[model samples]
Target chain A: MLTLKQDHSTLIVLSVLADGPSYGYAISKAIAAKSDGHFKLTASGMYPLLTKLEKQGLVTTSWEEVKAEGADPDATGRRRKWYTLSPKGHKQLAKHIEANRQMQALLDAFVAPAVNDQNAHA
Target chain B: MKHTHGNTPKPKPPTSRDGIETWLDVLTSMLSLPSSQRTQVRDELEDHLRSRVDDLLVLGKSEAEAIRTAISELGETAQLARHISSASRTPKSFRRFAMNATFFVLAGSVLTASVSMMIPTHTNTTLPGATEAIVVETAEVTEPIRHRFNHEREPVVDVLQSIATAYGLSFRFSDGVRKSPFGKTILDTQLNTFKGEYTLKEAIDAFQARMYMTYGETVLAMTENELILMTLEEHKRMQIEIQAYQIPSWAESDDDQRNYGFSIEQLISTKHDLEYTTIQPVNGSLVVAAPPEVHAEIISMAAQLEAIGKSMQAQKTQQRIEQHAQMTRRIDRLRAEYEAAKSVYFAEREKANEFSNRIDELRSRRLFVRSNDELSKEQQEALQTQINNLGEQSKQQEITTDEAKARFERLQSILIDAESELILSDINDALPIEGMNDSKDEMRTVSIMGTANMRSGIYQLPEAGKLTLARFLMAADVQDPNGKVLLQRGGVSEPIGTVGDISSGTIDSIVLLPDDQVVITAAD
Candidate 1:
């Protein structure tokens, strides 16, 4: 599996949250599923990115208690933090997509010659 | 989707299984964040771990194996902690570059300089003066410059000029020496005593020594990046300075004030020509008049003396504190000994009282038997033997009581001295409590052989103490103990006793004390 760099990982996470609000585990699953098992974002990478995004005001977070079955109603259960993309985050994601597209076009200019040579040889 | 929460939710408490909990504990301990943030991060990670573990469990993995797989997916705990810490502290900008030693990238504004040498003359005429403007160009060399000069036969003047050119130095000769010189003096000298890697200072010193041996009246003076060969008499005419150095407070007494000047004079005279220097005691300070270089040496010497004074004061204070602590430890040891002896004394006294009571009772019984005339003679004789046996036991008890009393009195006397003791008191019976743990703190080797479950080799006890057979077996992780255990002590060939199952109650109670060897073999 390919490990994503910080900027790419941030762009992916922000793109995932653009659809709707989601928690850390669900976002990780979405990244893996969306990339078809080719990409993995572990909990270590997931929560810190979420925290940095929250600090930057690109994402806002809220907590919900996830009580286990047959657990005490009065007892506080495990907390699940949900991160939602802000309006600023939507703009940031748009900028990232445009930047990524420009980078790919510039890289393809260099790579196309090698491909054409391989095809000619074949 | 977000659910409404009235208050902040508490973190998930640790469960009994604790596999995931232990991982979180280690991960959180490495995070140098605020407690609230650490807790939030821990809870968030714990939730992620639980969700992953559940997913793995659904795919037919055991709870323990699922936890392990989930943890492995998170990568190394330390690396994860580092990432989280770096992220939370603030996003950082990183730059990376590489350079080979042969090539270095200089900044655009920096001008590189290369140095080239020019040797013009063999005579010491037109030497560079104090106001001479020397425009030097320095080149950056990655490696150290090594000098090697092997001359079978050469003029000293030519060799000196070569050294001056190679090391970028200029030379001057005093007027007296210039006038008295004659004939081309050919000498053989090996100036590279340090092979090839000698520093500039060592090379100059080596050449100076050779000059001194050849011309005993002349000395080489090196200062301010220049070398001067002059007779010892002419060196005193150079630049001189007079400075007043206030002696440190500890050496301000009359005798020390008188002697401090001589000490400084003695120190600098060995290395430099101190013929023009004079030291006089003036109002608790040394008024010294010497050359500028000698004055620099004197200032350095004064600083060193001040440091020595402070160090001596510190040492005295440290010695006092150590002496006080030694006295305190001795007192504590004496107190423990006194308490032990007191206990022993009381126990012996109680035993002696019991013996006395039993003897008295036996005497009363004998008197009653004598009063009852119908009693048989054999029964009376048996009663008499029992009374005699009780009397002998009482005598032994008295001896033990005396010994216990003596020990108690010895400790009491030491304790009395400890009350007035400014120093450590010498107490005879200063045994530690339990009287065995002192040796137990030392490491000792315990050899094991012919073991069915455990490896047959010398296993060192983590400590030197009375280790029981059961505890040793438990520590060694020996299982299926259906064997006979034998112990040997003091290098004895004969086995002491055959111990039964180490897991059982009665036989496992046997102690495997310090320096003992045990052999466990299967019952055939």
Candidate 2:
């Protein structure tokens, strides 16, 4: 129901990857499930960020072939790119988490006073 | 399955596959990434799309509906392509500007010092007393000076001396600059001698340009009312700096980029004899450690090489077009010659046949007259004489016919040779001839036929010098001790010698020219 900006998307993706190595689709699925289908990172946004992360050495990628169930053994099935959070990526995730906490605290400071004022008027 | 990137051909997109493949093909083709990366990206995306489609299908959706739903989820193809391109491509402007900035910084730092050293402290006044360090101020250094040669061909020393006399200034020359390799001093080098008026700097720069063009390297600088001349190499030794030069992209592939690097190195370092300089090719750019002037020279040389390469490529295409046209013309001429020879042969054969028929009629008349017994003895004798004369004419006609047939056969052989030459010429254009002499005369080839220790093929010759039979045999590694060798030149074949005799210096006078063939046969 909400479109995620790049910084938030990167934080979410890196946080999802912090748990374990996951491909684009699995990462997308995890984002949807964690947000309860509220946060959305489209394919266009996901891939370029992943590419930038890989370029920055924050993530490492390897490919594996995925075959359909009951497919012939000799066939070269579909390929999936697996991305893993590097040591740098873990450090980045910690920084983002701390920044998010500070931002949440700062916003509560402003919103809590506004809510109290509205309740008093009521 | 273990995925490998090797020589294996890339897998083709699956057949439509409910339009998934068609959509992927369109997206992949629009990608601006290099081939290997493009293929990897496509494979990765295909897996994601297929996984999404399968998930949709599992949710009780029809196949078509699932495919359509999955396709819509990928967002617009063009936007995705642009994002990937922007993310993947290295910032070219930043790279180019960085390289330029490095070179200019090095050059600017060096030239700043060199320029200050060249500034004059005082002004020039007296001609003869100028040798006592005539002081020319920096402002007066740009003042126009008159220099005129007394004669048409004046020595460089006299010309400079005349300029010194007219301006009341002194000139100094380094020992290397004064000494010419061909003569005692560069001062002895002749110049046409310009009569035009120019500022001191302009005059010296103009003279330096001329000297650099004619000779190899010369540098001139002015300091304190004195003109200083020295070799560019010596000037470069004063300051050494490392600068990165961006080789213009002549080709898109890595191999061609490396070749451009090599070509620039060969032109700048090797060809120009920049001995103490080090040139390294780094990521499609040349990093050179040399003097500031030498760096300037290298950049100039690289530009010239690129221009030359483009020019040579254009010339080669033109040569190929001309070669094809020439071959066609030669073949047409041969065909015409063959047709003319055939006509001559037929005419000779007809003349011979007529002579034979006339001789037969004469014999028939003689026989009839003898049978009549009523004819005079003189009449019978006349008939016999006519038959004998006609027999002689028929014999001559037969000889002429044989000559025409031989001529026709010779022309036929020539026509066949010409056609074969055309074929070989075409083959030469298609593929470079292997095992050829490393020669600048790439256009010339010699054919070796009729058996040899080596393969019978057209071989290229050296740019210059005779390709004698003995030398060719040795070069070809022909070791047939008892094989007779014949040299075929211009459709005429003559025995050069036995391979053993030729190799042993017994028969070494036979020289093979371009288009010449060497025929080998087992010794009788």
> What is the lDDT of every predicted structure here?
0.61, 0.62
Expressed as tens digits, the lDDT of each residue in B313-360 for candidate 2 is 667757866886787798789889889989999999999999888888
Window of ten residues with lowest summed lDDT in model 2 chain B:
B134-143
Q: In candidate 1, how many Å is residue B200 off?
A: 36
Residue-by-residue lDDT tens digits, candidate 1, B238-311: 43445566665557578898788888888888998777888888776677777655666765565577568667
Chain A TM per candidate, in order of listing = 0.90, 0.94
The total number of steric clashes, by the backbone 3 Å criterion, in model 2 comes to 6
The candidate scoring highest on DockQ is: 2
Model 1 per-residue lDDT at B352: 97
Cα displacement (angstroms), candidate 1, residue B37, comes to: 0.8
DockQ of each: 0.10, 0.11
